[model samples]
Target: MADVRIIGLDIAKSVFQLHGVDDAGATVLQKRLTRARLLPFFEKLPPCLIGVEACATSHFWARELTKLGHEVKLMPAQYVKPYVKRQKNDMADAEAIAEAVTRPSMRFVGPKSPDEQSAMMLHKVRLMLTRQLIMITNATRAHMAEFGLIAPVGRGGVDRLLAIIDDQTDERIPAQARSCLQMLVAQLRLVKLQILDNDRQVLTLARSTELGRRLMEVPGIGPLVASALVACVPDPSMFRCGRNMAAWLGLVPKQNSSGGKERLGSITKAGNRYLRQMLFAGAMAVIRRAMQGTRRTWLIRLLERRKPKVAAMALANKNARIAWAMMMSGEGYREPMAIAA
Candidate 1:
């Protein structure tokens, strides 16, 4: 135990597998500990390097281990996958983590703070609520349509349906169907209120931090996007450049190059799917406004040559790079006109 220099911990709900090695990369200990015994075991162990996969409760464990004076490195599970031997089990995974962490070229994920984790949770819940809102709205619309109560597709249509439900004398909708639809209407109202509250919370979070404020200065980023970025990227310095950030967001094209021949495919769509979606939505919002305005910004020019969706992607990628640069430099966004001048 005293000789253990590097420890790889495979964490789970109750049991954890640990693989410990010495400075020369020789195994010194292999053990399993329960959830209750984990901290006590680490408490007695000497301060050393610990490797953990960046998965479900990884950040919490990393923080806990760091408090014990052990240097903790969180490696992305995908990056550690290559190090695993044929047989896959807790022991093998632990060993692979130990070996991978020792490599100088290995990439690592920085452990997020509790606040960052909380912010991410908030955003996820908001998204789930938003999806529920859509489900309720669609269900209500379909139910009403069966009774021949169709209206134009939009908020106005939904409003007309609700008004029909509210009218006591409306015989078009059967009593049973009307009762069930009232339940849906109640749910839709509740979800919309919840979504509004979440939006308020997101806006407050964005306005409360200097970093978030700076991020919002970018053209396509608003409260939700800015706040999500702050939570998702706790350490922007991990990226070497703005393009690296964009690539991390999976905005760049997939590459298949060999023998000096390069082939690029569609965007990898690899990183945080939620963030990528938010960026695309924001870019589309900007493109919509640009298409209507007289301004000839770069985005407008791109829209002229490419399809709107493709142009939106290009704008999203550009916005990601710009956001990364701003975060890295502690600088606010600058307009293209200002930069040109």
Candidate 2:
């Protein structure tokens, strides 16, 4: 450990590989350490630059390493991929990270705070539970339909079934079918309760933050969307402009350019899927209100002439830009120009 200046750590659950370089970009140390020995190894070394990919647990370690006085850089995995040499291995990957972090133009991800990570984990749990509940509900409905009994679409149908089960004199449903419906209704109720709890958690988290408060001023950005945005984007300054923010969120269209002609395709859909989905959902909500004359201006007028889904996506992109502006400018959401709507 001859005054290591830069160290690249290839992290894993049990074992970690380290590639250390001196001030002159010469390999000074290459070592493997178990999870238990990682901190101890770094504890003996003077504070230096450490680099890791922005994957699972990266932020946690970044925060930990920062606390230990090391400068940590979390690079996106894609950005480091090009640096990989002819063969890819833990040692090679560690070396690539070492090399990548030394570049003057390298961009690194800002490590998310504990609170942001917690909110993100809650959102993930809520999404998983909601998907499971939907699957159960659909399976129950399909099973019922096979017996010449059709369950109506949407939650209303589930409510109707629950009411029938509670009724003392309803004979339309057979006993066995009633039993199954009762079971499903019970499960649905449990899931709905969990969803309410998750929503409350999201709201509670959102209400305690300045960014969340500002985001609330934006139309259609409720507790969930605000919290997700806050969690996903730890540092808005990472983006140079609103368009950079939109591109980071994968709201921008993919471009295919050849010769002198340029064509743009659908959104890249490359970043956080949960955040993108929440933004799209918020946009759809806004579009619904816009459709009802809530805002009859240029954007709305243009939307009226295009497919609703397309308009919704366009609105989502606009909302991403506005969000970026609000974050960067330290201002609340403002209505777009009257003509632009």
Each prediction's TM-score versus the true structure: 0.96, 0.91
In Å, residue 183's CA in model 2 sits off its true spot by 4.6
Clash count for each candidate, listed in order shown: 0, 0
What does the lDDT come to for candidate 2? 0.86
Per-residue lDDT value at 262 in model 2: 93
Per-residue CA lDDT of model 2 for 1-341, tens digit only, reads 85799999999998999999999999998999999999988888899999999998899889989989999999989989899999999999999999999898898899989887898999999999899799878877776666665657878886665676667577777788778777887887898899899989999999889989999888878889888888888889898988888788788889998998999998899778888889889888988887888657765887869887778778788888888888888887767684366
Q: Which candidate is the best by lDDT?
A: 1
Q: Give candidate 1 regions above 4 Å deviation.
A: none
Off by over 4 Å in 2: 162-183, 337-341
**RMSDs, each prediction?**
1.4, 2.6
lDDT of 2 at 209: 94
lDDT of 1 by residue, 1-341 (tens): 88999999999999999999998989999999999999999999999999999999999999999999999999889999999999999999999999999999988888999999999998999999999988999999888889878889899889988999988799998999889999999999999999999999999999999999998888789999999999999999998898988998899999999999999999999788999999999999989998999978777788889999999899999999998888888888888788889
